[model samples]
Target: MNTTSLPKPNSMEFDIHAKLKAANSHWSYCYAVHPHDKGFDYQFNTTFVGEMEFAVYERIENYFVLVDFFKSYDEACDDAKKIIDDHPDIKKMFSVS
Candidate 1:
């Protein structure tokens, strides 16, 4: 069996480019709560279907804060898993239903 190891993720993410778009720009996405969410309607949104369009996202306080646009959804999922596993408190603090 040939298995490749995933790259180590950083504790903090940095943005290389700032979005300098006009205010109130239109966006397209779907909002979904975390699989373990069981609280309020706080949710995360994805611009594309993860498996079909290869989008990965991170949620914070009812917002999909981090967008892995270029990264594959699978890769982004692996990284997100690492983050959640490393800090279990995130789920409890900001769980969405």
Candidate 2:
């Protein structure tokens, strides 16, 4: 819960808001991860926001980025929790679509 000593992440390579827009633009939703630079791609797809579907591609020195795709809002939140359990420092970086 304490972030005072956490290392700052680099700028995102991919745009979170952009992905959210594309996800909300239609039924297809997306979830992915990217570092401040172009280097890799996802951590994958899951069931959709209502119906059914996803990336995790981020690496900044000693850090690893992870992303999860879901079928509902609950799924997204759940994934966020799990991620936080393992990566509490990146909690603020999470974006919802």
Candidate 3:
């Protein structure tokens, strides 16, 4: 009798292109209140070519005080919050539920 060992399956690799496509396909907007700035910011995830992209915009009065683009929404939000929190004059802003 001969016994054969089953080959182990390789861990799934993250497909950057596929993920970017999916993220763009399901593109939706979300935002988090800045812990120190009473300003509104917009965030969205998109795909460019075959790479993931993220964007954030903060409007102050009638001008955009902050405009940022990132590789992921999570990173964009994190950076935006840090900026808002660092300003002592700004207060965290939130939307009404």
| Model 3 regions lying over 4 Å from their true place | 1-47, 73-77, 81-97
TM of each candidate vs. truth: 0.27, 0.22, 0.30
Candidate 1 lDDT score relative to the true structure: 0.38
Ranking by lDDT: 3, 2, 1
Give the Å error, residue 68, model 2: 10
Largest lDDT belongs to which candidate? Answer: 3
Model 3 lowest lDDT segment of ten: 1-10
* Shift in Å, residue 65, candidate 3: 3.7
Candidate 2 lDDT trough over 10 residues, lowest sum: 1-10
| Of candidates 3 and 2, the better by lDDT | 3
Write down the RMSD of candidate 2 (Cα, Å). 15.6
- Highest TM-score scorer: 3
The order of the candidates by TM-score, greatest first, is 3, 1, 2
Q: Residues 1-97, candidate 1, lDDT per residue (tens digit)? A: 1123233335645231221122122232335556576454333233433322223345556655444322232344445545544555643433455
